[model samples]
Target: MKPRILYLATADARGHLMRAQLLAHALIERGAEVEVLTTSDEGATFLGEFGIAAEVLSRHYAVQFDERQNMQRGATDGNVARYLFDPRHMLRDIWRLRRRIAAVDLLVNDSFHPALLVMGCLPGWRRKIVHVYGASLRRALLDNFQGRLPNWLARGFAAAISSELRRARACLQHDFAYAAPARVAPRLFNLPTPIALAQLPQQVQGPRAAVYLNPHFRDPQLATGLEQGLAAMGLQALLVGEGYAGRAGWTPRDPQWIDAAAHSALIVSAPGMAALSVAQVYRRPILLLVTDQPEQRSNAARAADLGLVHEVVCWSGDARLFAIQVQEALQRLRAVAIEEGADAGSQRARQRLDAWVDCLLELAAEPR
Candidate 1:
């Protein structure tokens, strides 16, 4: 009998939904029945782009970000506190999940929703949950309380995170760069991003760039800067992301974005794990556009430390100044030669995917 899997994805960022889409597609190909539930309509729409149907959760909770894509800690804290304390709504969602999990053989929580986190820590559900998230996210959570909260509150928060992690059947933490897989904790394993390399279409290399940004980025000036910089370099580019749909010079979201990325001479995007993984897998040089967000900042720093990024561009608070920086960065990035060779990143990701699925099936087959 095929294992029925329930994947709960959080919509705080697009990376979580992307991971869910990739893993669910792999599971379906392996004859597993998979159902995806996401926290927001945005996530549902994103999954729809790749022909992956997902149900939007009724109780929505997302980390707040400012217009510039910077995480707003206070706003996020208030919303989370209200959502967790509101018994009428919180309990309704929790109970709904409780009923749903009864029918599934396994629950795959990607970066997780708060309600799902609560449910995973429950007596019966923890045995079925396999939590998947990027290491950067785990860092963000721990970094949130650093010197910002009272000592007691910080200790309590850390304990809560550890307790939740301890309850999960397994925890898979993915990284951006290639590294030897390791068992990080009692139930936690660290590996490369489980991207579907087989699905990435081969495209002829060209002197163009593929640019993508998530909806969380609402800086019009940054978009303008990107456009102007690419134009100044005389490079043909396809720009896609939230807030660029109806605008001139911006292309609609192409389902073949990975193909485009593979064909392009350069890849430009926010410091997202999905984009970074794709860049590495395709062996393409990527220019990271870093905002004030801690996750992005940290990711960019890591990529640089690992010598993965071709160039890094930080926002200078002025569109014109940023445009200049963009042009300079691209000029430098174009000069760097890309070596043609075997796809090591893709090979590693495929291996990780197989091992990930094996873990899932093994857990699902265990006697309850």
Candidate 2:
């Protein structure tokens, strides 16, 4: 019988699913049976669009956001605590997943901690287990210790999450030009951004900023001043998000992203792995929009520190002042060069994953 692999992907962000979809397809082509389990309605639907049918967990496991639309750790912990307090929800989740695992030969988790607790760590699981992470709780804790959260609290949470990561036989992190992770699990593979190569535009346009905003901070009111600021600077700004989805010269989605980037002088967006990948692919300059999320803020900061991005700004909700800042970003974009190597880095990561999966299959076929 062919080895079967089960993947539990959290619907926390669109990028996570994008990365998982690419990997899943690669594995299937390499001759393994794969099943995906998600806890997101949107993720399940998105997976279907790619011709991958995934089972949606009965319970809603979507990340809880604060009023600011940033992920709130307290709310997230409370959501997970329900399973501990209520035996029924816990048992139902376990039963459903266990039945799916009846013939599975390996477990692969894409940052889904609940599944690790429910299934991956179970005894006699019969195959190699792999854990994948796009972002790290430990990295967040270390980065935000002095700024966002108290040091003790950050340490506590980071330690807890880092401990849980050790459950898998191996861990793979999708990263790029990053500082060393705070606490890496044993047998961890700190790979580069797993972006697929694509054609980039040879001739580029000028004086336009491609705005790719995250859905979390897609509020029109918050962006109103920034929009006005861009207009004041005489630069054409095209907003790429749900609020501005599909209008003339505006693409409110990632599908239209490369085309939009081709028409832009620079890209303005929160720092997301996928957005950064888009910018990398198109070789566009980036102007970071600081948001409440630590991941985005840190990514923007780290990129700037590495000289990959031009400028990073926090919205002051003042159009006149912000316009001046936007001008500065424009100038910076023109003055610096975007570092080259993502294509080579991503290619190496793909080869590594393929080799690892092949090794696992070969081991499973060996006699005890």
Scored by lDDT, the top model is 1
What is the per-residue lDDT of model 2 for residues 218-317, given as tens digits with 9 covering 90 to 100? 4544566567657766777667654445434445455445455644677887677666655654466777777567677667766755556557777665
lDDT tens readout by residue for model 1, 2-52: 989999888888778877888888888888899999988877988999878
The TM-scores, one per candidate, come to: 0.93, 0.77
Q: Largest TM-score belongs to which candidate? A: 1
Clashes of each: 0, 1
Q: Model 2 scores what on Cα lDDT?
A: 0.62
Candidate 2: the clashing residue pairs are 245-252
